[model samples]
Target: MSRLFVTGRSGFVGQHLEAALLVLPTADWQLIESARFDLLDPASLDAALAETCPDAVIHLAGQTFVPEAFRDPQRTFEVNLLGTLNLLQALKRRGFSGTFLYVSSGDVYGRVDESDMPIAEHLMVKPRNPYAVSKVSAELLCQQWAYTESWRVMIARPFNHIGSGQNESFLVADMARQLVRIKRGLQAPVLHVGDVDVTRDFLDVRDVVAAYLLLLEKGQRGEVYNLCSGVERRVSELIMDMAHLAGVTVTFKQNPGKFRRAEQRRVVGCSEKIQKQTGWKPHAEFSETLLSVLSDWEVREAH
Candidate 1:
């Protein structure tokens, strides 16, 4: 059986990816999560690589909060950038000759031009926020590893991924969680929102994980692939759709404080590269994604 070592096994994406992998039939793969403080302790990480000797490492552990990254840039870099370095170094030290999957974000293409509609992989990276900067830095680091050391690496830039098990801090989850509360009367009928007019390429976490697995199977080493829905939805429309799914009459309140600086008005990406390479296309429709998320929240609230 091939062993897969996942760095952020406890995160929302990590959890979903793990569950998805459990059901695959063609491959018998065992996923091992990081038990040590990844960025802070190098010795512990080295020990894990020595023991697991995994056939692949999916690096998912990092500081993901954009707003939080703005609040503490140093902390963001410490985890996203330095943490990635630690993992790469550990893998090198342990002499693990396996494919490394770097889970990056589409936010790396910050403040894109209108002509860059459906941003492609070749676009120049212009990270506006600390979170994007950190991800870009990590991507560069992974590229360096592939170029200098000849490590097999595939970088996946997944756009806004949403589904169940996601924390309420995220936009879609926040809307779903708030709608659940409003239905249960646990909170007011008011839903707090930041910039609802912004458009983003939101893909279901299921599709994103499938793309990751596809990358592992058919992706070219030393290449960067995008995982996107190729469909952009306004935040306002998403919340309204989610509210409609919940069958609730909720009022939305715009909280300026809740808004983050450097918020992009529109963000979309092209998954053509990945699709052409792996023949992977997203199957979940927007309505299905919305209803699924709301249904999951309702179940969670009932419990």
Candidate 2:
């Protein structure tokens, strides 16, 4: 049995990943709870590490919301960068010789040109927001540890992943929530949307978690991988699909408040490297994923 320590176990992606790990039929993997551990507290992190002695760790805890990061960049940096530093320090003090995976974001490739449609791992990182900047900074820190401390570290840059239990702060979840309300006759048949013209690469949260698991087993140390669908999908298309799934004819009204002035017009990624290394590919159908998200919102709205 191998012990695995996972940060942010209660968050959206973290929750899905923990669920996947439970059902996976490989080794007997045990999870170390992060509930009592605070990333900003070195003592707490050290205590958790000392108690668990994990064979591998998946770092998922961070200030994830972009708008929240914008509202407080200092806090974002403290949690993302300094928090990562403290974790590494604790592990080093414990003389850890295990695999560590840093879950970064594709937002690090902020505001890419059309020619950079399929952003690769080699593309220059141009972070456009505080959250993206923090991720990029943390990535650099992880890479440094990999090189200097001889720790087995890998970074994953995942694009937008949607699934059940996701808070409505996200774009797709917000759309699904509105659609659910409309379907239940609790609201009008009009969906307030942001910039739907922009395109993004989205994968199911389940698929994303699977890729993370594979990377833990097969990914090369100090290497970075992109976990994405490799398909550029328009937000408008997703909105339409959600509406159809909810059996509602909805009209969209552009919400200026929801729009991000620095948003990239198009963002896609190439997952070829990870596929070649781990033989991992997205298995969820787009419509099925969409329907699942809608169903999740329906359940939430009914309560």
Candidate 3:
């Protein structure tokens, strides 16, 4: 059996990825989570690596929230940039040689023009936020290690992914949470939102995890791939769809406090590269994904 060491295994995407790996038909894989390893401490990371000695490492642990990164750029840099550096140093010290997948965000392609509607891997990255900056920096760091070491380092830049068990802090989850409350009569029949005019490419978290697995199995060394659905949907349409799924009547109210000054007007991605190479494509229906998220919120709110 091949052992895989995974960071951020308890997080939103990490949890789902773990669940997906558990039910796989092949019994040749074992997942080891880095929950016991602190990214800020190199000694702890070294000890963890020495213990697990995995055949591959998936680096998913990082500062993900944009607004939170803005609030504390230092912590974001410390965790996202310095933390990755420490991981690399520890791997070098252990003379590790295996695949290392770095999970990045589509936010790295910040402020793109409409002409670049379906952003491709060739587009230049212009990160606009602290969180995105940190991710881009880490990507460069991983590339350096890939060049210097014999390890196969790959990066997966996934677009906006949403599904069940996501925290309410995220866009779709917040909408579902509010809709659940409205349906339960616990809150007013109103949904507060921000910048609904903007459009984004939303991929189901399950599909994202599937792409990650395919990338690990077949992706090229020292290459980057975008894991996204090529379809762009407006936020306003998503809100209406969620309300319809929840069978709730709701009126929208613009929340000024929730508005982001640097929000991209439209963000989409082309997955033709990964699809052609890995033979992976998104399979979840839009309505099904929304309904699943709403249903999950309903269950959580009931308790």
Each model's C-alpha lDDT?
0.88, 0.90, 0.91
Off by over 4 Å in 1: none
Candidate 1 residue pairs in backbone clash: none
Candidate 3 lDDT tens digits, 1-303: 888888888899989989988897853568964448899999899888876677888898988989898899999999999999998888888777989999999999999999987999999999999999999999999999899889999999999999999989899999999999998899999899888999999999999989888888889999999999999899999899889989988999999977875789998899999999999999999999999999899899989
lDDT tens readout by residue for model 2, 25-49: 8846688764478889999988887
lDDT (Cα, tens digit) per residue for candidate 1, span 95-210: 77888999999999999887889899999999999999999999999998989876689999999999988888888988898999998889898999998888999999999988
Q: What is the lDDT of residue 303 in candidate 3?
A: 93
| Pairs in clash, predicted candidate 2 | none
lDDT of 1 at 273: 96
How do the predictions measure up, each by TM-score? 0.96, 0.97, 0.97
Worst 10 residues of 2 by lDDT: 27-36
Show model 2 residue runs off by greater than 4 Å: none
